[model samples]
Target: MKRTSSLAIRTASAALTALLALSATACGGSGAPKSRSGGPVWAEGQGATEAVGFMRVQTPAGAAEMKGAVQHGFQDTTYLLSFAASTGDAEAFVADLRPEEALRANIPRDSTTYTTITPWSHLGLPEPETQQKVRTASVCPPCIKDERRSAVQSITIFVQDIGDGRARVYLKAF
Candidate 1:
C-alpha cells in the first residue's frame, strides 16, 4: 500500500508539471513578441496626418500659444507641440481635430495591436496637474512603413485645464 501511494503521488506530480508546461505554451509563454517596427504596438495604424494638418490650420492661435509653451531645445523635434489657452477653447480645439481613421480611445498595452489610441499615462509618463479636467489622445498611424507618411509616427496629446478658462496642451511622440 505504501509503494502504491508513493507511485500515485509521483504520477500526480508529473501530471501537474505537464499541465503547467502546457498552460504556459498555450498562453504564449512570457514576454511580448519581438516587433520589427520597434515602435509601440499602438503605433501601427493610419497616422495623424489629417489631424495635424487640421490643427495647423484651425489652431493658428494655439500655434502662437505654443511658441511660448514649447521648451527651447525641443522645438526642433518632430511631432512635438505645446500650447496654452482657455479651457473651453482648448477642449473645442481637440474636439474639432479628428483622425482620418477611428482611434481606440483607451490606454494600450504591449499586446495592443495596430490602429489604436492609448492614454498618455500608459506611456509611463508623469501626468500634469489640472484644475478642471484633462484630456488625451493617442495615435499610431497605419502607414508606418510608407515612405510618404506624413502623420506623426506615434503621438500622444494631453490637454489640461489650469483654471479660469486657461489650459495647457502638450504633445509627445514615440
Candidate 2:
C-alpha cells in the first residue's frame, strides 16, 4: 500500500544521508576541520591594544611599542605579542609569569641572539637586526621534556636586553 511505500522511502533517504556523512568523514572531511575558522588571520599594531586584545596583561611601565599577530593554520592557531620596556619592567614581567617549569627545562638557559622570528613566526615584527642579551621562558600545560607541544593553550616568552636600560619582551601563545 501507499503507507508501506512511504515508510520505505523515508528509511532509504535516512540511510543515504548517513552513508554520505560517513563517506565524507572517512575521506578526510570536506576540506578543513570543523573546529576552526575557514581561513588564517594576521594583524599588528604600534601599541598594546592589539596585543592586549589577544592576551590578558597590563601594559608595563615605559612600554615603548607593542605588536600582536596571529596565524590560523588548517588545524592550529599561533599568537605572537611583543613589547619594549625598561629593564626593570622586563625583569618584573618575567617574574610575574607563573609556572616557569617548561622554560626552565628547555635547553640553552639564555642567549644573546634575537629569537628567530620570520613572517611565519611573528607576522613580521621589526626586531633589532643585532643581538644583545635574551632571556627565554615558556608555558604549555601538555609539554614534556625534550618535546614541546600544546594542549588547550601554550605560551613562550622572550625578554631581550636591547641595552640602554631597556628590554624587549616577546610572547608567543597558541
Summarize candidate 2's per-residue lDDT along 77-154 as a digit string, tens digits.
Answer: 666678889989877766655545533322342334545433423435544333346556776545533132333366
How big is the positional error of residue 95 in model 2, measured in Å on the Cα after superposition? 1.7
Give each model a TM-score: 0.37, 0.53
The candidate scoring highest on lDDT is 2
Give the CA lDDT, 0 to 100, for residue 54 in model 2: 51
Candidate 1 CA-lDDT value: 0.49
**Which 10 residues in a row give candidate 2 its minimum summed lDDT?**
102-111
